[model samples]
Every structure is written in C-alpha cells, then in structure tokens.
Target chain A: MQDQVRSNVVEILTQAIPSLESKDSFALAALSDRAIELAAVFHDEDALGIALVTYAFGKLVSRGGEEKPLAPMILLLQTAVNALSSDDNSAYKKSIQRLTRHIQMVDNKINLYFQEILEKARIKKGSKLFESGFSIAAVASLLGISQWELARYVGNTTVQETQPLHTLSVGKRLKIARGLFT
Target chain B: MKTLVFDSGPIISLTGNNLLWILEPLRDAFHGTFLIPRSVYYEIVEHPLVMKRFKFEAYQVRQQLEIGVLTLIDDAKVAKLGDELLLLANNIFSSRGQPLRICQRGEMEALAVSILKNASAVVMDERITRTVVEQPASLQKILRHRFHNAISMNATAAQKIVTTCKNISIIRSVELATIAYERGLLDKYLSRKSSAEERSSLLDSVLWAVKLHGAAVSEDEINEILRIEK
Candidate 1:
C-alpha cells in the first residue's frame, strides 16, 4: 500500500525550482505518490527522495511561515534514497528502518517538488565543476556519486578550447605583487 | 636556440607557492627561449584572471609574459601534431572498452610545441603525461591494473610514440624550483635568519603542496629531491 503511494504521487511533475511554495498541495501530493516511478524514469532515486524530504519540510514552512531544522530530514531521506537505488532489496528494507527516527522531524505538509529541483541543481553544479578542470575524485565527492557514475557523464564531454577573458591587466598585477611583497 | 616548453600545471604551482619571482631569473640564466602554447596561456593566464581567487597569480604570469620571459605560440601552429599525439596517447591507454583521456588539450599542445621546437625539455607536472612520455611501460602497467587486463599498442604506433618522446625531456616543478633555489634566486624573497635545514624544509613543504595541488611529483620523488646534497 505504501509502495502504491510512493509510486503514484508525482506522475505529472515537470516544473523547476524558485516558485515552488505557491504550487498547490495537489501537485505536492502527486509528487509524493509518484516518487518511485519518477526515480526509475530519471534513474535517480536520491534526488526524488530529496524532493520528498523537502516537500515535508516545506509543509512546516507554510504552516508557521518560519525556517525549521531540516538537516535530520535531509540525512534520513538521503539514506532512504540510496537504499532505493541499491540493487539489494534487503539493504533497501534495512535502510528504511532508520527513517522512523525522524518521525517527529516535521509535520505532514511538505514542499516536495522544491527538494527535487534542488537535487537537480546539485547535479548540474557537479558537472560544471568537473568541466572546470577539478579532479574527478574531488567533484565526485562533492556530488555524492557512489560508484564513479559522474565519470561516465563527464568523460563523454570534451574540454572547451577557447581563450578565457582576462579581467586584470599586467600592470595592476605587478603593482599588487610589489605592494604585497614590499 | 634550444627551447623549453611549459604546461599550465608547473606555472600554476610556481604562482601558488609565491615563487613566480624566480621565473625571470631562471629564464635569464638559461640559454633558451621559454615557450608557452596558446592553450597553456589560456589555462594559466587568461582563465585565472577572470576568477577572483587566482587573479593575482594570473597577473604574476602576465608580468612574465610582459617582460618577455615567456613567449606565447599559437596552438594552431602545432594543432595537427597535438591532435595526432592526443589520439595516439588515448588509444594506447584505452585498454578496456572505455577510453582514458589522460592529458588535456593544453598538455598535448605543450608536447606538440616541445617536438616542433626541438625543445630541450618539457617542464610538466602531470603524472600520466609524464609517465606516458618518459616511461611507457609504467603507464601500460597502470592501465593494465586499471582495466584488469593486458594492454598493448601496435608495434608501429608504439615505436612512433617512443621516437617522438625520446627527444623530449620531462621534468617536474620540484626540479625547477630546486634549480631556482640552488642558483640563489629564492634568497632575496626568503629570510636569512633561517638555517639551511629550515630552508630545505620550507622548499620541501612548498613543493609538496604543489605536488598535492596537481603536479605529478610523487612523495618518494619529493623525498629524493630533498635529500640531494647541494
């Protein structure tokens, strides 16, 4: 029954972040239901879990109109998302057991779609960082890629071959270096 | 004149360690032109200036360019060679179904420039590039371990790479920095109150930091450089 709810919520989800709160609860409810199905389509379980966690957190915001401690929720959701993505069903079940610890973390209303958008943004930033000549390991750590999956995405792209624009002139640099040294 | 080609890593290492001042003196002492490929200039000079954190280092390099201690060459001049080398190098490492791109375009351009100019050496700090150019067997072994299989290149292509790499000497920034220190170029910037041991330790720390930052110098190699009797 819970599986049904998880897979039914966000079937029609397609909007980006920034204007998430004004989005009606019907949409949020839909996201919560279709989380698993969305995960399969995007091949990303963690992001959908992030979206769901944020949805729950968003609910508290709408009710009190104040910021709440969402860190614990974020952590729990991340674990659950990873569990879902795992091939082992026993591991997924074991991970979901820890979710009970965050039962009182937030109220029922969540800004679910907002969290999904945030996850997508993080992935985007990860690719950009990799492209900028940062080591693959460093970027992978930052993006929380579990199995060198980021490499496959990044390896396909080639480095941009253009001259970067210089903001500071040579004279200014010499002056600065001299001033700093002197 | 004999030439020495530079990649972006060593230059960035020098700047990051507050040792850009040594370049001019080193260039003045060496009897060869210091060549910087366009891609390298883009990496070390143009890219850094736009970002606030690296603007100062970028400027320091610009000063070197302004003073003619470093000369920029169009990458187009060696683009054909660079691309060929890049393709060959990647193919050599593509032991598994997946291809490994060990060197960036900038690094390839530097290698191209080194070959075209008949450079005395290519001062670079990237481990894979250094290994491929100077020690192909080591690179092949590494690729074998990475792919968990035997890696091989066609005899003709292997011969071609070996022939091209023979004329190119690969040195790390640690060596260049050591050379600069030995020639007393760093004395003006560093304090005189320190003992020789302290100076050596300071140099090791700076070189180690550069090694960590991305230059290919291994910990063992760094230790060897430090233990050298000057």
Candidate 2:
C-alpha cells in the first residue's frame, strides 16, 4: 500500500486478519507478518489488489544520468498476490477477479513498451540471426521469455513437444497467485 | 551502447507473439554473437518445469549452439539444492557446500561471463529475489530496462519498446507470428481468449513485462503488430 494510509497496519489487520481467522486455527506466517496483518483488514482483496498495482504505471523513464531505482514494493507485492490468487484456501474471491483484470491491463501496455526500446537498440543495417551469432537465449531474454518457451514458440525453433501445464492445488494455487498478482 | 545477456522471461513472451520464426532471422540478423551460458541451458532445459521447452529449442539450434561458459557449482551442494533452486531464486547461501547441495550453475556463469567480459549489462528477470550474490565491480552494468519498463508498465520506456517492436519490420512480424501459430504457442494464446477479461489480463502482463524487460514482444502484441502491418 502507498504510504498515505497513515493508520497503523498492525492495528488494522489485527482486526481484519482475524475476521477470516479461526480462533483455533491460524496462519502463523500471516499473523507474524506485519504487511499481511495490515493488508488483512482491507480483506476486500480487490481494493487492496488495485492499490498494489499502482506501481506499474511507468513504462520507461531516462534522464541525463541518474539510474532508475527499483519500482516500489508494488511489483514484489503483486508477484506475491499472483502466487496467492490461484490458491483457493487463501484466496478471497474478490481478489482473483481483481487480479485477472490487472494482468490484462499490464498485457495491453507491454507492446508499446517493447516498441520503444527496439528503437533504442536498433541494429546496424541488414543484420540477421545467423550473422549476429548471438545465442537464442540472449534473444529470448531480451524478449522476456524462458528459453524453453522461446524455442517452442518461435518459428522453425526445432523446439520439443508441449508438456501440459500442471494445475496447482487450490490452496497452493492461491498462494502462488497471490504472490504474483496482489 | 550496452550489451545484454538474455534470460528466461523474454523467451516465454516470444511464444505468445508467434515470433519464434524470427529466431532464425534474428539469429541471422544481429552482429555480435549472443550468449546462453551452459549453466543457463541446464536451468531452463534440464529442470522438469522448463525442460520440454528447452529440449524443443535445443534441437532447433543444435547445429549453431556453442557453450559459452560452464557454471561452476558446488558439486556437493547441487544435489541438495535440487528442486528448490528450480522453482526460482535470486541466490542460495550454502554454508554446507557439500555434495548434493547444488546452486544454479546458470546464474553463476551468466554473472561470471558478465564480470569476465567487463560487460555492462545483464538481462535477468528472476534475479531480484530474496537474496543476492556478490560480483566483481566490472560485472555491474545498466540493466536494459532499469531506466524504463521494470519499475512500472506506465513509464515512457515501456511505451517505446511496445511501439518499436510492433514495427520492427512488417514482413518479419507475419513470418514470426505464423511460426508461433504452427507451434502450440498459439493454442495457449487462443485458449485464454475464452473471455475478453482473460485476454486483457494476459495483455497487461505483456505490457508490464515489455516495459521492464526489453522489446521482447508478446503474442497479442505480435498479432496486433502483424495485423497492422498487413
């Protein structure tokens, strides 16, 4: 959450986390985590998810010489949210819906972003894959893909067969999803 | 001009764009030889999660592929770290660098190569995990998107990568997308089209990834770019 909250996160989630908490059973990790506790109160998963996404707003920013600082905790927070969204146990329904929306928005923005950089990394006229001698791995990473996936999806990649993507158990799924999205 | 080292994230994004065909052209197009340290090959190819994709690509570039550097892992620890390292990691501390406690050879080599070459850039999406590793001062360089895309999808940097990749060469965009269509990559892309909501969700991920990473285009963006080119 942005610093503007002003309220004590521990106090707020103390009330909110327990709302879903069973007196006899509880998440020690969650209870112990100050971030979780503060976030637990807003328990409206969707709103909190939105607040976390405020980070991805900048695509590219370059000035004379200052290097960019890491984006605020928002990206890390979203990754955690993504991990949780697929977990049925930890997932609140509202959160998943919100998360799905966020991914869509991010997807929409990636293209514009890529076009911007290709412009900067423009190659000398008439270079081709065979000539560059750059490994496929380098190209794949430049594009934000796993080498395996890159080999599979790229044309004439000579990539192997597609293995089915295994489904995650509900609780585990939500945990992972939460890590990624919210 | 800085040199970039490729990692796994950009590869996955390409499958979505149907741009794998471009690999052939790309492999032929660039001037400097790109690298995929041997350790990187093992992490992405040997691991159960990434293996299928790895094997598929291995066969394609089998003729051209060359080992850049072998990741020096604590042989003893590699066995122990096994699955944990595969899930995703920034760095693993191995007080017990005994046999069976392996760390990612891929990560080590990638870093080592950067340092050895006094290279200025490293392109790794997964490195910003809970831990970090020490490196020679020469190894440090500007992360390609460090200035733009990574922090957020809304930055000016993010906008540029997307637009430029969209226009890379109208002719190549189609050829690349078609190749992706022939492969199962299109299936994964279409399956999500089940709903606009799903489509949008996937799209945002592309936008953010492109901004942070380089011009690694997404399936949706490739499709859109090709359609525009057509």
Candidate 3:
C-alpha cells in the first residue's frame, strides 16, 4: 500500500512539476521529494513532511515561475486538518498548532493558502481561540522566512513575543561546545 | 525528496536554533519518523550534562523508528547497523573489543543503523563530517565505485539550506533576524552589521542571549548569528 502511494506521488510530482515549472525547478522538487521520501521511511513523518516540503517548495517554486495545484497542496493542508478535526490524534492538538505559523509562513504570496491554514487552526472544535504564547519568531524561522522582513510585517503587539522558555545555562551550553565525544 | 539521515549534529543544530520545529516538516516530509542509530540514542540520551536540558527520561523523539524516547527501536536492526558500521569505518573504527575505538564504534554503529534502516542518506554533524576533511578510506572507495553523486553540497548549498530553513521558520524576517542578532543568535553577523560602537552594544546583546536562549540557543539562532560574520 505504501509502495503504491509512494510511486504514485513520485510519478505525479515528476509529470506535473515538469509541466508547470522549468526543468531546474521541477528537478528541485523531484530531488527534494526523493530525499524526503527516503527520510520518511526512516521515520513516519515523511508524508506530512512531503506536504510541508511541498508547501515551502511550492512557495519557492512559484516565486521562481512555477505553478502549483490546489489539489496536491491539500495534502499538506489536510495534515493540519487531521490535527484539528480528527479524533485519533486528539492528544497531539498542541503539536498540531505548528500548522498555524507554517501556513502563515508558506502561501505567503498566495492568499488562499493562508485561508486554508487559518481555517484549520481556528476551527479545532472546543479549542480555545487563543494560544497566546505562539511566537512569530518561532513560526517565521520554521517557515524559512528572512528575519529582516519578518521584523517589519510581524508587529510586537499583534505578533506574540518572548514567551517560551528561552534560557540555557553555562554548564549545559559547554556540553554542546564540547562536541568532542571521546 | 532527498533522504536526510539524522546525526546528533543536525538535530542539535536544529534544536538549538529553534529549528527543531522543522522536525515537524521533516517528520512529515519523511512521513512522520526521524531515524537514527541505537548507539546514537545511548550517546544522545546518556550524556551527564545533557540531562540538564533534554530530559531523556521524559521526552522520546516521536518518529517512525522511535529508538529511545517515544518509540520502540528494532533491536535486531540496530545490531545490524552496528555490524555494517564496522565495515564502513573498519580501519579507524572497530565495534567490538577495542578500547581505543569506542567512539569509532559508536559512530560506525550510527552509519550502519542509517543504512540498515533504509535511510536514503546518512547525515552526521561531527567536526570531521563528510566535508572539510578527507573521506574515510572505505567511503572514498564507495563514492568512487557506487552512488552517482551530484548530491554534494558546496557553500552555496549551505547558504541555500540555511536561508530556506530560516525563512520556513519565519526567523529570517528582518525583525526576528535583528532580534536574533540582538539575542546573539547571529553574533558576528550582528557585529559586522553594526558600527564599531554598535559592536559593543551587539556584544552586550550576546550576553543577553546567553541569558535568553540558555538551554534554547538552537542552531538556527546560531546560524543567524554567524551570518553576520559571513
């Protein structure tokens, strides 16, 4: 079952990307997908990762004159849906919150993509309308945004600020520096 | 879909830089798993000082092959990785019965684990990674004979990945990028961007970041910092 899906995704992406993008652009998607898939089987996050890679890839690709379909984009979009509306993944709703900023980050040039993400993030049944702690910085970085631009568009008031635990002591810091594991 | 193998380096870089969030896409991109070697797990979780931050007793990185933290590891498979690692790093690293090669044993085990686990690629952030050093003798042979390799990264690739990663995380925004600099995430970059007097202010900011991101001074933040110098 997974094999069929994998082959199908590769085939579709290969054919469709070429049709919509330049050779280099399509190749980037193809290569990235290939890498993501290999990473996927190693762990299980490949599909969603592909969706996300697609999300980010699409934005980058589009900017490079590549066009993407709303159909396939839905897969990555739906992962967020599953997070919000699905019952099986209830406990993981918090993790699902990640979709909010990613959606905001991607589809930046495209309004529809933003809407899709906002809907999922906002509509989780019974979820409080607020996770006031979500950081725009965290979101922006995850989405491959440039800090210079982020500082401008994301305001301090509307954009949540320095809320998450952000400290590491000297002792812990040195351990990372002493990366030598002998 | 390029396959990326996880070694402690990328994970640490990502985690430190607040790029761990990419694990979301990464986990999703890979269909929800993060693969690593079992020996690697012992290495990551067993550190005495490491306990100060990532409490292994509590958090298991949830992935397809949850080796140590949240998921179960396939022991037989892990041992298989250990075996293959022995071959990959044979001269320098011996898995069994060598007191001097303990670290090599650990590293080889990671490589083998990556291969046996069907990983598309193996990754490591060790100081002596695939680049910036001569290839391991055996791997040199493999690159020569197998693998039709256009996948190598040069500085451009590094910059691209870094830039792309930063954008995805929204850390690349001017405000955040500046904030990152202020926080010492991009120390040298911040310093260079500043006037000579601003350098002092920037250094002061670094001290602030030492306080701000204490345990959280992730690699992305660091990258933002280094970009200043670059």
Candidate 4:
C-alpha cells in the first residue's frame, strides 16, 4: 500500500513538474525532502507521508499563477481521489469525502512534525528560499525559525548579492528603540 | 555599560514559563542594557502575532517594549554591522562545505549589536548559534557524539570559523534565571502555599521547561543545577 501511494505521488509530481516555474519546483522539492525524511523516520511503508506530500504539493501548485485552474494540479488531485477511492468511479461524493479526510489527517501529522522536520530542512532549503528571493523574515517564518536562527543561514545562502532588503528602516527602528528604552 | 542582547527563543522561553518578570530585577542588579535586534523583534512579535495561540505572548512582549524592559536596537550602525556579520559568518560555514546555516539574521544582529555596543554577552537559548559563536569546536563535538556526519572538513576551514567567531560571549536564559534566583526574584513568584522543598522543586521544574525549550542547558547541566545546595 505504501509503495502504491509513493508511486502515485511520484507520478503526479513528475507530471506536474513541467508546468511549474523554478521556485515552485524548488518548493516542491523541499516538500518531497520532508516527505522522504518522514517516511524514513517513521519507517512508514503506508505512504501516509506521500499522501500528505501530494496534498501539500497540490496546494503550492494551486497557489501559484492565479485565476487559472492549474490544470495539471487539478488532474493530479483527481487522480489521487480516484486512486484513493479504490477505482470507484461511480461514488463521486463519497470519494471526495474520503480524499478530504485523508488529506486532513496527513495535514495534521505534517504540522505535528513541522518544527522537527523544518529545523533540519532549513540547512538545505533556507538557501533555496533565499535564492528564490524570499526575504530573511519571510524565509525564517516559512522554516519556523526565529530571524536570529535564519540570519546565520542567510549568509551561506545563494541569494543574489544585492543590497539586503529592509523590513524596517534604521531610522524607524531607532525611533522605536528610543521610545522603548527612554 | 555592558549590554546583553537577546534572541527570540530566550524571550519566548522566559515568557512561556511566565518568567518575564525576572528580567526587571535581572536588569536592575546587572546594571546593563537589554537589547532586542529588529529581526528578533519580527520573530517574537510581528510573525507570532498572526497566530492565535501566540498572540498573547506577543502582546506581553510588546508590553515589555512599551514599558522599557526590552529595548529595540535597530539603527543604521547596528543594521550595517549585522549585514556584514551575516555575510562573514555564513561564508565561513559554507567554506567548510557543511553549508549549515548555523545562525539567523537576528542572532547575527545580536552578535553585531554586542560587538558594536561593546556589550557583555549575547543571551540566547539556542544551542547551535551559541556553539557557532562561543565554541565552534563544540559543533564538531556534537556532530560526532550526537549526530553522526559522513562529511569531513579541512582544518583550514574549521580554523576560519573559530577566528571569525572569537570574543563573542554567549549566555542563556537559564543563567539569567539563575541570577534572578540568587536575587530572590524567583522566590517572589513561587507559591506561598507550598513548602520550601516544594518551592525548590518548582524552581527546578521551571529550569527543566526552559531547557526543553532550547535554553542551552543540557540534561546533565540541569540535573547538576537541580542538585545544587540551595
């Protein structure tokens, strides 16, 4: 069962890859890394991680390039629903319900381990996020780290060496600083 | 005056344990400044505010800001210093081919602030950042002892990290709490209904929770602290 679901996820992500932009693919890869690590840690053969990964991938793909249906992602979701429903093409409503519930359970577990997995993933993916043009604070939040934790990674990241973007200006920070201290 | 820069984790750890109250007396007796970098502010304040569960803690931290217990250290000099340190530190890590992002912008900012202000110490609860700053050797020690790494590094690269991280003093929230404990600030917060022994256990419990939340206190260290003659 795990092998079946893993194959399904690999097929779906590979098919969707062509349609994705670079950063989207990069984010997908991060999610894939997380799923693989979780699978290894839990020694899970049931592909619970894959189901969660696919659902997360679907969400990321859907979030990109607004308005359009993201046809590949829709197709992927439909394929997952069909696979999850055990070939019951007729039970459209019931299959949708099962898919939703399964995705939810996977989501819950993903969030449960988010702090643990993302802490490790930050080593590789932090630079990826920076290279993909996320600001220090943005990447830090995405990785579930404090800006202090993310700062050290930013130095090693492959971000384009432009002037570092300011979330708060020096003058503004000082004003707030003085107000707090005085 | 000597300065102590705080990272978000220690703030969260202190506040989570309902021990933010200790900072006031800690500051009074220490006769130093408590600085919060802008990036740490974003983590403990701006980002967490969006989450329902952390909004209260965020609010409490904000109150500290307003009352002058925690001062924000955002300015041109500090920001520029922070950027330089970020590049320098990260370069050292990647140079070793480890590519481990051992510190974040806020931690870098904290270090930069400590350096620029001629501060006394960087108060942080994070083990990785502390190891990178005060003891790069410990990074290899931890990796070998705890996490078995297959990759190896050249001696020159390791030396670079050590040189770059020199002269940075690292302290943890546990130490600040210890200060508060000695000053009798912790006793004020303890339950009067409990006996002296129970109160001591309660203090240990607080230390245990902070350690669990990344206070840089090892289990052995915490056990020793608990067994200390009080």
Residue A136 lDDT (model 3): 24
Residue B41 error, candidate 3, Å? 2.2
Interface RMSD of 2: 18.8
Best by DockQ: 4
The lDDT values for all models are 0.55, 0.31, 0.35, 0.55
Docking class of 2: incorrect
Q: Which digits, one per residue and each the tens of the lDDT, describe model 3 over residues B62-140?
A: 3323432123344776676456434333223211222111123344444554454554444343322221112222222
Model 4 spans > 4 angstroms off: A1-182, B92-98, B141-149, B152-161, B189-196
- Candidate 3 has an lDDT of 0.35
Q: What is the TM-score of each predicted model, taking all chains together? A: 0.57, 0.28, 0.29, 0.59
Error of 2 at B122 (Å): 3.0
Weakest ten-residue segment in model 1 chain A by summed lDDT: A159-168
Instruction: Write down the worst ten-residue block by lDDT for model 1 chain B.
Output: B93-102
> Residue-wise lDDT of candidate 4 within B20-58, one digit each (tens)?
877776666657778898988887888778877478888
The value of fnat for model 3 is: 0.00
Better of 1 and 3 by DockQ: 1
- On TM-score, the leading prediction is 4
> Which sequence of candidate numbers ranks them by TM-score, best first?
4, 1, 3, 2
**Model 1 over residues B86-198: C-alpha lDDT tens digits?**
77665555433444454556677889999999887777755456555655555554445333455565556556776777777666576777776666666665676978887
